[model samples]
Target: MTSPRFVIIGAGLAGAKTAESLRAKGFNGQVTIVGDEEQLPYERPPLSKDYLVGNAARDSLYVHDAEWYSDQRVELRTGIRATRIDRTSRRVELSDGAGLGYDKLLLATGASPRLLPDTAGVHYLRRIEDSDRLKRLFTTAASLIVVGGGWIGLEAAAAARQAGLAATVVEALELPLLPALGRDVATVFADLHRQHGVDLRLGIQVEHVGNDGQGTRVRLADGSVLEADAVVAGIGAVPNTGLAEACGLRVDNGVVVDANLRTSDPDIFAAGDVASVYHPLLGRHLRVEHWASALKQPAAAAASMLDKDEAYDELPYFYTDQYDLGMEFLGTIDGHDRVVFRGDLPGREFIAFWLKNNRVRAGMNVNIWDVTGPIKALIRAGRPVHPDRLADPGIPLDQVATA
Candidate 1:
């Protein structure tokens, strides 16, 4: 009998990691990775930060060198797109007219940046080419306009400030990160950027944009205009669920998966931003687009594929760095009513906990490193914590979880 074959789509971190995990889990079958990008699978987090700032080199962005893939006996079909998944034949049809059969398949086709109607000098940062273009544009550009006040947009604005360019951010919401952090916490970011010389315009919408000889003109809804050398729209991202949806898989919110990250078809699985798995903590399907989820989900996916009874049940975690503030946030803040702070918010060093009925539901530590474990413990305990003790730095978080 021929050895079982495993095929993975979308050679980003999740796909690459799934291949590595399959070997670690002792699946030792024929493994093939298909990706649309010409380059090898690389990390995306640095593209907006270190890579954009010129502190990191291109080669460092790759998850693993070419030798690692060859050493692991993994076939890499880069620069090729997986056009269709033939469920009846258990094969994936490639754009090059080749069909690869797979006993088990994993789809990790990541998301693409949400775009706006095109105008000259407009940019969207998602791939290596996007960052490279911004690098060249930043060299000579004196002013930049950033659309959308989310993490991506703010990070880009921070990079522009670091580049000594005048950065102005336009956000339609009242405050940046309002959807995720709520107004109270989001205001902190608004102040942080303003203090760093970022001209943050809130509660405004961009009606239209056009490029002319002077520069790029961004027209506002209230009959105002802003000019800049270049404009970047970092509104959000939409998952690449075309292949999964086309194959007749359930795609509510995202490709719906159970606790095991298996799609509607038993032989197929998905992990990453594209797969909306049932979250134990949230009591519903939650689709996270953070780097931590992409890094961690593949292990569970590989294990489940091998019938190991593994489940992706860990709470979500993500981090960011802007100017001098570095933060690690654990868990979601949905249904959270009150926020309790430990340490000094004015000093920009503290841990904030979101409480739902006095139970710690989520926590964020800013400029306070190495307490993620304790924070997660408090959240997972699901016990009511005294607001005073939670607000007091004198009490360690682990003790608070128990007390």
Candidate 2:
């Protein structure tokens, strides 16, 4: 039997890992990867943290070097955008006037930063080039005005602090990271920046941004104006689902997919931030921007394509380094009303567990040593931990699940 041709849209983690999973499953079919970026699939998590701090090199951020793709026999079509998806003919049209035929398709187009059009002085930190340009600004600028209190914004603020630049962050929301994190956990970040000398302005919106040769002026809705050498934006992201929507695929919140990660059209599948996959545990479709979700979902989609039945049931985990502190979030946080913490808050370390009905549903750890196995077990076994034992650092967090 001839191996089927597989065309994957997006060369990010989802598209790249799907190809790797295909070869790992012993399917030797034609795999062509289409991406708009010039570089091959590389890790994005570090782009705002270590990469932005100038600690990690560009080559190191790549999951696989040139050798891995060559060995896996994956054809890379970088610097090409999939303009249209002809589900009727099972082909994708590229901007460069090339069309690729496929028996199966995977949409991993991912997400793009929310950037204001033609904004004179503000920049968004989304890709390598975006950070590279920001880094240049970092070297010359004396002060930085960051808009938004999201992860990207907070992370950049941390980087700006590390660079010894006078950094000021303006968040429209009441608290930084209030959308994703509960107030209790968000406070940790709010404190982290303030303690590090970040001029945090919360509950403020940018009314107008005007720039001159000397610096940029950011006028706030609260009748205040702040000037700085440059402005960096850390507003969230919007899923790149336009092509999928144009293809007549259902795109409610994102590219809707069943529990099996199959799109409305069975021949075409979608994953990553662009995919709104049904979560059986959550009892609804969820779009997780976490790295683990992006890495795990595409494997299930590929397995389903190769006639392997696997329900992508792994937990989600994402880690971020803000200055010298390391923070990690695991499991699902929805429907969690109660949270219990492990370790002291003043000792510059702690872990917050999101509990629903006395069982751990999600968690966030700050500076806790070797917490991976414990967080996974807490989610897996539905562990119920005591509040007192959790608050004591001597209690060894990894053993909490067993205790």
Candidate 3:
């Protein structure tokens, strides 16, 4: 009998890691990875932070060395797109008029940045090329106008400030990251950027973006205009679910998957930004588009494909580095009512917790290192705690769980 064949779509971190996990788990069958990008599989976080600012080397972005695939007997098919999935025949149709039969399949198609309505003179930060273009613009540009005050926009603004460029951020919301971090915590970011000399235009919309003879021009809803050498739009991202939807694999906001990362079809699985996984702890489906999910979900997907059946119930995790502030957030604030902070909020060194009915739901550590384990423990504890004890700096995090 022929050995079982495994095929993975998308060649980002999740796809690369899934292939690595499969080999580690002793899947000696034929393995193939299909990606549309010409470059090797790489991580996306640095594209906005270190790589964007020229602090990180380009070679550092790749997941593994170029020779790793050949050494492991894994077929790395870059610059090829997976156009369709033939479920009945268990094959994947390629853009180059080729097909690969698979006993099991994994989709880690990731996501693309949402473009501005008028993208004539707008830039986005999703791929390496995008960051390279921004880096080149920063070297010569005198000013930058960033649209959408989300993480990507904020990080790019911070990079622009670092490059000595005048930066302005425009957001429709009252505060940046309001929906994700809530008002109290989001205020900290608003202040952080303002203190760094970023001209933030909040609760406002961009009327239009176009290029003039001098440079890029931005028209605001308030009948105001601003010109800059470049403009970047980091509004949000949409999952790459066209292949999944075409194959009828059940797609909601993304490809819906069970606790084990197994999609509607038993033979197909999904991970990374494209998978809306059911969280056992939250008791609902949560789709996370963060580095942590992309880095960690592949292991569970590999195990599920091998019939190991271990649930991927890890709490959502993400972190950011902007200017001098470094933060790590764990869990989600889905239904939290209030936030409690420990440490110095004014000094930007603190740990904030989101609680629902006195039970910890999420936590964020700002410039506070070596506390992620404790924060994760508190969220997983799922028990009520005294607000006073949680707020007290003298009390240990582990002890605060019962206090």
Candidate 4:
């Protein structure tokens, strides 16, 4: 019997994990991983937080050691980008004009950062090289003007504060992180930074960036200008879906995939940020950009590729290391109808629960991750809970949970 030939794209956490899962699932076929980045499949979460502070070194970024790849008998190709896919031939064309035929192909190309157009000294961090460049400039910069109050912007701002750089965050919206977290919850985080000496600029629009030779100047709609040693934009990211689009497959904001993470073509599949996957749990096509989602979704995609007796309906969860707090959140937040609080906001030890018709829809705990199991089960079962009991922090979360 002939073995299966598997080809995976974009060797980030998603691509790397899928290859490992293939081997873990007992498939010993020829697995080829093609990636654009020169470095091994590394974790991107640390690049913005610990990596900038000198706590996390480059060596620690690798998701799997070199030996693991060799042991798994996986063909790893780094520093190579896939140009297009020829679905008719079941082949992927590389930048250098070479082609690799595959019985199954997984698209895990993540996302690219959005930068301010035609602006000099404008930087966006998404790769290892971006981290290195930012770190060098951070050492000399005294003040920084950060555009965009999203996760990347705020995280980088936190790192700048640690490096003794005076940082100012400008958000066009009423509050930073508005679309992700509710406005009320965002206030607590805003206060956390303001107390830590960060200048929070909210509800203002940056018209343009005009340079005056010595440093960069950010012009605002209110006729106010902020001069700083450096200007960093942490705006947002667009998924890399061009490859999938060129192949004449279904492409929306991201590559559209079914519940099992399979693309329109049964032979092709997609995971990671580039995939607008149908999530059974949420009952919607969600494109999550979290690191945890990228790592876990790939395995599910691979499982379906191999025709495993399983479904890829995973509970969505993500967290961020902002300031000194470890913010952990679980379940979906969009469909949630009601919200319950377990603790006080000013106290810094609290959990916010999003309830959907009496059931816990989503929950977020600051510096708390131990009780995630019960919250996860409740969301899966769509169980209901009393408002009073859910609001009391004195009652343990696991007590209300059933097997």
Candidate 5:
């Protein structure tokens, strides 16, 4: 009998980690990674912050050095796209007319940045190439018009501000990050940017955009025009599930997977932004698009592929940085009743805890360091906490949580 060969599609963090996990678990089978991008798998969060600000070197972005791949004996097929998956034959067809057979398949195709209607000089920050282009643009571009108030948009605006370029942020909602962070918490970010001289326009939509003599012209729904040297749309991202959908796999928002990260077909699995996986803690299908999920899911998925009966049940976590503000959020904000503050909100150094039924459902640390462990503990404890103790900075979270 021969060992099964594992073939993974997409060469991002999830895909790279999948190969490493498979080997770490003592899987002596062949491992291959196929990716459309030419470069090796690399970290993405820094692309918006350090890389954009010219503080990090390009080599620092990669998940591993060139020698590691060869040392691990993992075959990397770069600059090649996987066109289709033939389930019955258990093989994947690539754009280069090559087909690779696999006993098990993992899809970590990730996601693509959502784009607006065609407009000249409009950019999106997603890939290394996108960052490289924007880096060049920032060298001489005087002003930037950023659409959407999401993390990416805010991060881009922060980078632009750091570069001494004028930045204007346009959000359709009443406040920035309204959908994700809610009103009370989003206000913190809104104030952070405004304090740094960001021209934030809220409660408006971009009706049309076109090239103008100034560089780019944007028309708002309320009949106003704003000109800038460049325009960037960080609205959102669409999961790359074309191959999964075309192959008759169950896809709802993303490739639907069970607790074990197995797709509709038992032989196929998915992770990262492309998978809507069942989370035991949440008791629901959650698709997280953060670097944390991408870095964590692959190990669980790889273990499951080897019939270890493991589950990817970790709580979803994400972090962001803007100007001087840095934040780390743990768990989901769904069904949270009210937010309780532990420190000084005015001082911009506090921890926000979202409570439901007097129990902590989620919590975020803004500009606070060395407190994530306690925050996660409180969330997992799931015991009712006194509001006064939770709000009082003198009462440590460890004491407030009922262990």
Candidate 6:
């Protein structure tokens, strides 16, 4: 009898962790990871944070040591792209004219950065090379103009400021992170960047981006002109769902999967940024593009592939470090009626809870540490609490749930 073969597409954090989980769970089956990049699987958070600012080393981005794959018997195929998924024969065709048969397959294809209409000279901070290029550009460039005011744009702007480059952020919305954190908490971030000498152009759109004789030229919708030594578009990302869509898998905002991370096909699964997983707790399909999903979703995906019947119920979580503010946001702010604040909001040390029907739906800890457990507990408990007690610093987070 032959051992079952497991093939994972996209050798990223999710893929690496899935392979690791399979080995840790006593699965001696054949495991193969396929990636388009020549380099080994690596994490991406530092690309815009410590890495862009030269605080972190290049080696720190890798998910594992080079020898780990060879030791674990996991076939790591770099510089190979999975072009086609033949569901009938249970085989995957590669870009290099190779096919691999698999008993089970996992799609960790992740996402690609959404590019602007004209990206000729624009820098995007998605890959390691992009980060490296931007870091080098920071030293030579005197000014940078970031085309979006989202997390990526803001972080890139912060990195430029830290590197002594004049940075400007242009956003179409009224405030940065307004859709994600709402205006109440989003105001804090706007102030933080302004305080750090970032020129924020909010409620404006970029009409055209082109290079002039001197440098990059940006024209805003309001007929304003801005020029900078370099430009970066940190607008957003779209899931890599072409393979899934072509193979007849359900693809909505991303590859649709159940609570177990199982796709439409029983033998195929998806995790990480590409998987629009059905959250049992939230009762909706959520496609998160943060590092937390890539870091943690693999365990449940591996379990499902092994037919263990485990479900991935972890809430959507993400964190960001910009200037002096470090924040961890757990849960979703989809349908929250109001945001309750605890601790000192002015001092940037507080926990903000998104409440629906007075029940804690989501929470964010800004410059506050060691409160994730209690916040998660409160969100899971689904109990109503008095707004006064929930906003009081004197009351412990655990006790506030009952109050």
In terms of lDDT, the best-performing candidate is 3
Report the C-alpha lDDT of model 5 over 1-403, residue by residue, as the tens digit.
Answer: 8868999999999999999999999988899999999999999998889999899999999999888999998999999999999999999999999999999999999999998876567899999999998888899999999999999999999999999999999999999998898889999999999999999999999998898566999999999999999999999999999999999999999999999999999999999999999999788999999999999999899998898888988888999988888999999888889889989899989999989988998899989998999989888888988878999999888888644
C-alpha-based local distance difference test score of model 1: 0.92
Q: Write down the TM-score of every candidate.
A: 0.98, 0.94, 0.99, 0.95, 0.98, 0.99
Off by over 4 Å in 4: 335-337, 398-403
| Per-residue C-alpha lDDT of model 3 across residues 292-393, encoded as one tens digit per residue | 999999999999989897899999999999999999999998789999999999999999999999999999999999999999999998989887799998
Tens-digit lDDT string for candidate 4 (263-283): 999999999888898877777
TM-score of 4: 0.95
Better of 2 and 3 by lDDT: 3
Candidate 2 yields a Cα-based lDDT of 0.85
Candidate 5 stretches with Cα past 4 Å from truth are 401-403
Give the clashing pairs for model 2.
Answer: none
Q: lDDT of each model, Cα atoms only? A: 0.92, 0.85, 0.95, 0.86, 0.93, 0.94
Q: Please provide, for model 1 over 1-403, each residue's C-alpha lDDT reduced to its tens digit, 9 standing for 90 to 100.
A: 8999999999999999999999999888899999999999999988889899898999999999999999999999999999999999999999998999999999999899888776466899889999989988889999999999999899999999999999999999999999989877898899999999999999999889898867899999899999999999999999999999999999986789888989999999999989999987678999999999889999999998897878888898889989899999999999899999899898899999999999988899999989998998888889988898889999877667534
Per-residue lDDT over 131-218 for candidate 2, one digit per residue giving the tens place of the 0 to 100 score: 8998888888889999989888999999988988999999988899987788888888899899999999998788887888789999
Error of 1 at 207 (Å): 1.0
Q: Is candidate 4 or candidate 5 better by TM-score?
A: 5
Query: Residue 2 of candidate 3: its Cα lDDT?
Result: 97
Better of 5 and 6 by lDDT: 6
- Stretches > 4 Å off in candidate 3: none
Q: Report the error of model 6 at residue 368, Å.
A: 1.0
Identify the superior model by TM-score, candidate 1 or candidate 4.
1
Per-candidate clashes, comma-separated: 0, 0, 0, 0, 0, 0
Runs of candidate 1 exceeding 4 Å displacement = 401-403
